[model samples]
Target: MPKLITGGVAVVLCAVIVVHLGLGAAGVGVLDVLSFVAGNGDENTRNVLWGSRIPRTLAGLVVGIALGVSGALIQGATRNPLAAPDTLGVNAGAYFAVAALAFAGVNAGVFGNGGVAFLGGLAAVALVYLLTVGGVLTPGRVLLAGATVSLIGMAGAEFLQILDEHQTRGLFFWGNGSLMQTGLDRPLVVGAVVLAGAALAPLLARSLDLLSLGDETAQAMGVQVNRVRPMALSLAVVLAAAAVTVAGPIGFVGLIAPVAVRLLGIHGHSLLIPLAGLTAATLVLAADAAAQVALPPSAGYGELPVGIVTALIGGPIFIVLARRVITGDADRGAAVVVAQARKSRFVTALVIGCGLLAVAAVVGLRVGDMDISWSDLASVVTGSGQEMANAVVSFRLPRILVAAGAGACLAIAGVAVQSVVRNPLAEPGLMGITGGASAAAMLVILVIPSAPVAVLPVAATAGGVLAMVIIVLIARQLDPTRVVLIGLGMAATTMALVNVMVVGAQMNITAALTWLAGSTYARDLSTLGWLLLPAVVAVMLIVGGRAVNMLALGDDLPRSLGLALGRTRMLVLCGGALLAAGTAAAVGTVGFVGLVAPHLARRIVGTATHRLMPMAAVLGAVLVVVADTVGRSVLAPTEIPVGIVTALLGTPYLVWLLRAK
Candidate 1:
């Protein structure tokens, strides 16, 4: 059976390779490929085959193999079925390192780039390992830590991309995993490293197989469990880094390939390793071939990256698998629990936080290109200020209000989602609500160019709700980790489609990009009005806070306590989605404010949703207002996006949260 399966995969991979090499903008047929190899083809055919098609096909093949083997090794070492480069933060870390190098003008060779990527991936996974409670790795902890790290790394890369868009065009395309190559140079170099990694991988198969028998058992059997696991992981990182260097962090081939191979009943590392590689190569080849036709370069749409196609396909597959992931043991209770505090103290904190937020707002208004003093600001309110002050205040107040309102909405959304999911780490932005809003809004902008600004918030909210519904429906067991993974997949799908839209739009996408980055620059009073929906949603969530509290008490308990688990979850999630959608519409896709504020409020006031919600709203408002202020002031004329600023600020908090006892 194993032999038959391996043979089947190999045959499919070879067929895909041939087809991928033949079909492209140049339209080389199989006959042309054979003829070119026989030295009897036309020069155009030869040029297409040699210059572009062959190299690209080889790149896909090599990267696929590398990613597959890496995924298998990591899964083996971790004893977690969901382990993969992307989910482990390896891909993001590697990509960030390469992007940083490029941004800093390092301009290294292929080997140097691979080395840097390896270091970055290694460091990231090290952090993940260290944060595992008592050094006992669990699937949930690894995934949670990975998601957090990936967010930080991707946010940093986005910041750099935003800082210098023109200089980073090549880097941006590469970051998206373009397989369009002019020559065989990169393919040859990267292919060699991948092949070397693949060769070394089999030697670790015995050690990995033993380690999978659990650390104590393996140790008793005379396996150096600690050394073997680290070595296996190191090799996996090397493989992933090589693939990333060549293909720019293409995702999910590693995940799906190994998982598929395992499901075929081939568990022996010797057979599994090779079969996984063959399967992944087939997937990559097929995705690349489809991409050419999906958005043909010949059609003037430019070739879509193979990575985007793989992500779109892989996302649904991941969601399906997530539905089946065992939920019983994956649960990790709330990360932080604090003693209940006095209501007076909570009230004092809320007042202080709100007051600080107001002061931040005033400070924000007072600064900018043209500064405004307190007296001048007061005069503006009374219609007695200088013309410039009035003009500046008018311009600043709308953006400030939008930021504050969006932040508050998002924070409340976070509180509601975290409670409903019973996961302290839950955030609407991370769970794809914001991404859904952005994608829907982009579609409205592109497809219905006449869409009024007012239509966006409504459209965005609808999209967010739709995405949340899909994610929940896909989740068979409402496991927080599974839901989070499904959400990540949804976000990837929307973002990939959004990327395709941006590429095909053929117009200035500056506004769309700014919004996607969660910026408030040039936002107007109409934006403030969009906050009304979220504000209403916030009120609803606060009113329903008792249900949220009940939800945190596990599934059966809530139902036993006369709380309708399904109905309560649905209501809270809807409210969360509405809030997130409104915020996304108003300020693009600001992240982490929702995540950080709720956690902070929780630590301060305990887990009573009522107290936590209001305090979180205040903190959330303050966070965004301060973030916007810092964003504008940091880069001077070239403003950093508030989304990016929040990410930078929130990442440290996330790390501390992860490490918290």
Candidate 2:
């Protein structure tokens, strides 16, 4: 059966490659390609074949093979079906390394990027491995750790892109994994490396088979488990790096390829390796062909990235995998695992936290290139400040308010979400609310450029509500793992749709990028005014905190206590959506604040929902205020986005929390 399936996949792959090579804007047929190859066609046919279509086809093939084989190695070594280069941060690491080189004023060619990408992938996977070493290396733990590292890598890359928008246009196109090659040089170079890596991979086939028997058994059987593990992983990284160099970090090919082969019941590394390569190649070719025809190169909408197409397809597949029986501790333990504080103590902590937020806001006002002293700050309030200081304060205050308000809103949103889901990891980003708001906001920006500023927040809010409804409906069982995975699928779908809009509309992506990165760079008081609704929602949430607290007792207990469980959940969910929407409207989906702030507040103030709600809001405010301040002052004229700053700050704490016993 496996052999038959593999043979079928091979035939389909060939058919796809052939069809793709002949179809394009030029309308060249298979016969034309054959004639050009046979030296009997005209110059136009020759130019189309040899110059564009042939090189593109070859690049996709090489990329597919590389990603598939690498994914197989990662999953086999990790003994985790969810393991893939993209999921494990290897692809993001590679893309960031290349983007960093470009951002640093280096035009390092394809080879340079490949080398750096290899190192970056190695480093990222090493961190993930280290995080899991003391544990039993469960699939859930490894996947979450990979997700954390991926977030950090992506944030770093986005920071670099924000630094030099003009010089990085090529990087952006490449970052999205476009396969618009003009010549064969890149494919040839990357293909040589991929072939070399593939040839070397089978040497560890015997050891890999043994390792799958578990590390202790493999070690007892005279396999140098440590050495063999690293060797296999290194080979995988090398292949992924080569693929990224050729196709700009195309995601999910590595993931889907191996998973697809495994579903066909292939397990031996010797067989799985080659079959996975063929499967991935076929998937990539099919995706590229679909992308070409869906928008059509002749339609003038520009070619959609094959990466987007693959993501749109792979997300549902991932959701299915997540829902199936798998190995790991999927149960997220304890809603709040911290020492309980007294009412007075909770008040003290909330006061202290709010005080810190205020201090951070003041520092933000005074700490830019032109610093404003306390006297200047007072004088500005009194209308007697120096003109320069007054100007600086005027420029800074609105963004500071927006940051604080958005942070508080997000933190409160997290608290509300975690209450109902009973999972500490539940946040707006994980629920697809952020992605939905982003997609809707981008649509408004591109489709109605003449619309008033007020329209964005309303559109964003409506989108958030829509996404929340979808997540709620689909996650009827409300299993934390299933809900999160469903949300991930929805998020990926929305992001893919957004990418299509960006490429199709040829919109000015600068503002969109800033919003996506969650920047407060040029936000004004009007944006702050829009945050009032979220603030009001936060207050309502806090007032109803006791009902939320009942959720911790599990479903039956809440019902027994006379709480309208369904109605309360519905109301809280709506409140959560409103908070996220308001913040997205104000500052563009600032990530991690919602995830991190609530946890920190729980640690400091205990699990009483009423106390947790306000404490989390204060902490959230402090976090975004500090993040905004650091983002603006760290690089002076070149600002880092606040969203990136939050991710960099929060991911380590999240990793540690996951690693904790």
Candidate 3:
């Protein structure tokens, strides 16, 4: 049976290789390549095969093998079926390191680039290990920590890209895994490193097999468990980082390949590693081939990144894994208890928060590319200002209003979601709704260019609701962290959909990119209209805060209170979805405001949802306004996106929250 599986995968891999080589913009046929090898082909065919097709095909193999073997080793060492480079944040770390280097004007050669990626991946995986160790290393905990780290790393990379458009264009292919290549040097060098890692992987296989039986059993079997696990993970890092250096961070090839191999009843490390590599190569190559078939390069838009196709496929697989994996350990230390209720503190914080928000708006108005004095600002507000001051205020005022409105909506949404999920980490953005909204909005742009302007927010709302419903239905009664893990998978899938639509649009992607990054540039009062629906929803949520408070007391008590448990849960969740989706449609992502603001508010105002909701709204508005001000002032003219700034601010809080005893 093992022989049959290996042979079947090898055959599929070879077929995929052939198809990938044949399918490209140049239209190089197999016959032409064979003719070239026979010394009877034209110069065009020879150049096409040698310069582009062959190199790209080889790159796919190298990247696929690296990810597959790395994943197998990770799963083996940790004895966790869901362990993978992508799931542990290693790929995002590696990608971020490479982007950071390019932005810093470092022309590191191939080996140097690989080394940087290795260090970055090492740091990331080490952080995940530390985070998991703080609590128990459950599958859901590891994945949640990974999701947090990846969010931080990716946001940092995007921030750098926003500061440097030249580097952004240069790293585009690297940001998403692409098989396009200039020559064979990269594939050849990276392939040799991958081969070395694979060669060393078997040395630990015997130990890894024993380690799977638990540390006591492994020690009883005379295995040097500590040394063996670290060494194995180091080798895995080298392999995964090398793959990132060559073709960027490809998602899910690592996860799906090894899992598929194990499911085929081939569990021995020696045979599993090699066969999994073959299986991943087949999957990667086939995905690239499918991308070409779905959207040919000549379709005006450029070629789809092979990562997009793989992510779309991997998303469902991850959801399956998150659902079926034993997650009983997830809720062990995962209670979402807040500070003791303090009425005086809540009132004081609310007054102070509202005051600070007003101050922030005033400060933000005065801190643009050109600052207007206090007297000039007062004049602008009263419509008695100089022409220049009036124009600047006009430009900045609408953006500030939109920012405040969007922030309040996200915070209220967070209160509702956290109340329902009973998880402090349950932000609407993190729950995958924003990704759904962005994808749906992009779909409208791509599919119906002439669609009415009103259709966009409606489509976005429906998409977000559908995404949330899918997550709730699939992960019903599961651990909260497990549900969030599944939601992260859905988020990746939806983002891939957005990337596909953006690539297909072939129009000015600048506006879409800016919006997706959660910027307030060129936004006006017109954009404020999009926030009205969410604002109304926020009011409804705040009015029903007492019912939501009942939800956090676990299932039985809420039912005893005649709260119609299921209906309330769905209604509040859908209401939160409405708030978040509407905000996302109005103002891109603006991440972490939901998570951080509500969390901070709860600390100040306790868990009473009625008091918690309004305080969080005020704090959320203040946070974004401050972020917008800081972003504008940091660089003279290059404004950082508010989302990236908020992410940086919120990442540490998330880490601390998860790691707390």
Candidate 4:
């Protein structure tokens, strides 16, 4: 009964906000809109009502309800409150599909674009699901897989945007999330799709309730877990795709709406589902109103993308919720502790792994643009070849060192973050440290182009630290997984910020492309020196204490061990910030070295203690240097960014890991 009342209030609020907002060139009041609607008003007012305000309102309504319900379904299915259209790559898929079509000169009107977006969204969801395929769907695996796909999709989108300026403008505006009308057909189609999805959603409510009890329990209850899971997912994808097609991928509404409903203590889907829809409606209406009024007029005449505005508000709220989860205030069952047991066989193999890294370093110098034989390498090292000595010393040697150092530093940061957070997936890149650093560095370059090159590292470090601090503070009260969710949120914000910057800069596209792709061997000696200093400092910090061990036991265990949890967390975070920032500042944002290295290390040396820290660091260096070498040699004159290469390699490995475990 209370749920119904709350929903009623939400609906009223949504209606008020929607009706009060003026539309188009001649703004009309609520009474004027109503008078025009009732067939008792001026032709201009009637045209304005039918042509602009009504379509805009309907778009908001349909899109809001779609995102809200879709969010709830995704969150329930994945058992992750952070799961939503944006987080799961549904919006990305839709946006990219439309953008591609636009660039291809496919004048797919709104309805045609909707169809394309729907297919694309379905494909993306299917890919994410397949990547994390296992006996049971785990939240962690789903999130990781979704994240990987989102990154790949976003990268593709950015690349396409660079290739076509007109499409880029269209996507940029669309990506911001708007309720502006292209035509009335869009709202009608979206409305029909949303209604169909809503009807199907209730049918899954029982299964969702059972599923929330987990796969084992649901199976025991004869829930046909497999079939039910896919059905729910299909419904969610349809809703999300429809929403994106109409409103251009508004973010966080779905994530925030269901969470809001859940927090309101409406657990039963019969009640929570409708209320969540209402909450979503209210949120979008409110956000749209704000976007119309609050932003500077010179920014954009139409409206700030409602999606970006939602992110600005919803990101912080999500972070707060995540912190609550991390602190064990929300869900105690979510906290995880890594066991402290070592295996001799794994340790032995890890030593062998280090030897392989040494070989990789040697090979890295020999496989670049100018391939030098081992004899040439030896001659150069021994100062025997005075002829090619300068070439070897100035170019090949520095490149090798850059690759090795960056790989090692990133790997160590990944391992340290995982240890500190007690989550195997807690890498710097995954957690937005690299993205933050990259964004900050880009800002520094844009605003103060004449600043010393050395300042890039400093700016990156500050950005990394700032990002880490935001995540930590927000997740301080949540569980490790929740902290990971907050990191994902930060990653989204950072990526969006980067996109905006790249679009607005009008800089050389090649430079932007190189940076986004994660090049590592572009720096001279001064940058190299800056990178090396931080790499050394990070290594020292990682090797310094038993804090790593205590941290793996989760927050409580560390406190019980008489460790100063706050100080230790700060120290580890600082080390990681320095490492990621310096590396990002030196090279571009290298991909999955940080993520893949620690997992690879754990597989070889076992997760016991920080005993494997050094091994992981060395292995990370090998992975990166080898990837860099492959990136350089594979295309000859045209070098692929090492980051892109790593993604290609690491994404598969991650999927394999998910399936194996």
- Candidate RMSDs in order: 2.3, 2.9, 1.8, 5.6
Residues 1-661, candidate 4, lDDT per residue (tens digit)? 6747785756686565546445445657667766765768788777777777778878888988899889888887777776888878888888778777877888977678888988878888987877766534545456656776776666556556544544445665676688888568889977998988887787888888888898899999989988987887788888888888888888889889999888767887766676777788888888777666655334444346678678777767766655544233133322222333345576577678778877887777777667777777788878786576457556766677778788888888887777677666677887888888988999999899999877888899899889988888776553556667789778767866765566456555456766766886565555568687667866686566477667656667779878998888778877887788778888878867877887777766676545567777788888888888887887676677788777778767655654553
The lDDT of each candidate is 0.83, 0.82, 0.85, 0.74
Q: Pick the candidate with the highest TM-score.
A: 3
The clash count for each model shown is 0, 0, 0, 11
Candidate achieving the largest lDDT: 3
Model 1, position 250, has a per-residue lDDT of 86
Q: What residue pairs clash in candidate 2, if any at all?
A: none
TM-score for each candidate, following the candidate numbering: 0.95, 0.92, 0.97, 0.76
How far does residue 332 in candidate 2 sit from its true spot (Å)?
A: 6.4
Flag regions of model 1 displaced more than 4 Å.
133-136, 327-344, 370-382, 507-511
True lDDT of residue 507, candidate 1: 41
Tens-digit lDDT string for candidate 1 (1-661): 8879988988888778878878876777877877776889998997788888888898888889999999999989888877888888898999999889878989798989999999989987887776675633557667778878888778888888878767545655677787777778888998888888888888878877887888898888888987888898999999999888888988888899989988899888988887888898899889888877777777887657778788888877777766666644335544332224434479888889989998999999998766778899999988899999988988889999988888899999998887777666778877888888888887888899997778888889988888888888887456766677778778888787777777667444454556677899988888788999899889988887888898877777888889888988898898999999888988888999888998888777878888999999999999999999998977777788899899999988887777766
Q: Judge candidate 4 against the unseen true structure and give its global Cα lDDT, from 0 to 1.
A: 0.74
Q: After superposition, how far is residue 318 of candidate 3 from its true place, in Å?
A: 0.5
Give the candidate order by descending lDDT.
3, 1, 2, 4
